[model samples]
Target: MTLQFSATALFAHHGGFGINVNPFETNLINLIIVIGVLVWFLRGFLGGMLERRRQAILADLSDAEDRLTRATAELTRAQGDLAAAQQKAETIRRDGVARAAAVREESEKRTIEEMARLKEDAVADLNAEAARVSDLLRREAARQAIEKALASLPKKLDAAAQSRLIDQSIRNLGNA
Candidate 1:
């Protein structure tokens, strides 16, 4: 075959390259029809998938909210329990302090009472000792007086006087 180099055959039309306004000649109408068919066919499938995904997200959000509510309630209950425990501990502390003070006061009172009793006993012992010593001194003085009188009696009395005194003592003994 022979190659024919004709400029009229190389370019079928005499117009140069430019934007084509005719949709059929440029195949733009076929592209629109193909896109419209694909959108219509896949609309239900894609819509169903998106609806299911949205429902799943809503359910997850609801579950998270419920968990948050439960956690908050539990925290509140724990705080209440902690407050009650603290109050109970404070009450116990106050009671312990009061009891300790009462015990201390009672101990002091006992100590004071014991001291008073010991003081009374000491005073009684002192009075008894003084009385005993006074009695002893009186007895000693009486004995000495009798001895002195007896010692002087021998010098002062003669035999006749001694006989008269003896006779008077016998008469006195007889009367008793």
Candidate 2:
């Protein structure tokens, strides 16, 4: 009346776990038929889809190429514009330098001329001052000489000399 367990019975096969060599029992022929039918039916659809995808990829590549070409052209144009601007700036800089040099030269010339004119004017003023001083000295000398002569004349003359000088002056006047 005891129950016994066997490890072999638990793992025993009822002919359901082995490889089958018969194609019909394994349904291998049906699987092949179904695969062949699906391939035949979906071939056109799959090919059309692949072709459309390829065309889209080519169009995208063409668009990218066009953009690259346009970008290159724009870059070239910008570089040319930059070169022209730089050339113009250089020209302006040269012109400014030349103009500055000319102005400096003109300023120097004017300064030299003005200095010469001032020097001439100073010389003329000095000459005028010298002439004025010389003329004043001559007038002073003459005045002093006249004062000395009048002062000595009163001392040298007496009453008899003054009477004879007066008699002689009257005779000269009568003759004239």
State each model's CA lDDT, in order: 0.81, 0.80
Model 1 lDDT per residue over 104-147, tens place: 99999999999999999999999999999988887687567656
Which ranges of candidate 1 are over 4 A from the true structure?
A: 1-17, 149-176
Judging by lDDT against the true structure, name the best candidate: 1
Q: Model 2 over residues 1-176: C-alpha lDDT tens digits?
A: 11333344334634334444556655678789999998988898898899999999999999999999999999999999999999999999999999999999999999999999999999999999999998888768756865675467667898687668657756854774
Which 10 successive residues of model 1 have the least lDDT summed? 1-10
TM-score leader: 1
Clashes of each: 0, 0
For model 2, give the 10-residue run with minimal summed lDDT.
1-10
On the 0 to 100 scale, the lDDT of residue 25 in model 1 is 56
Candidate 2, superposed: residue stretches over 4 Å from native? 1-21, 135-176
Alpha carbon lDDT at 58, candidate 2: 100
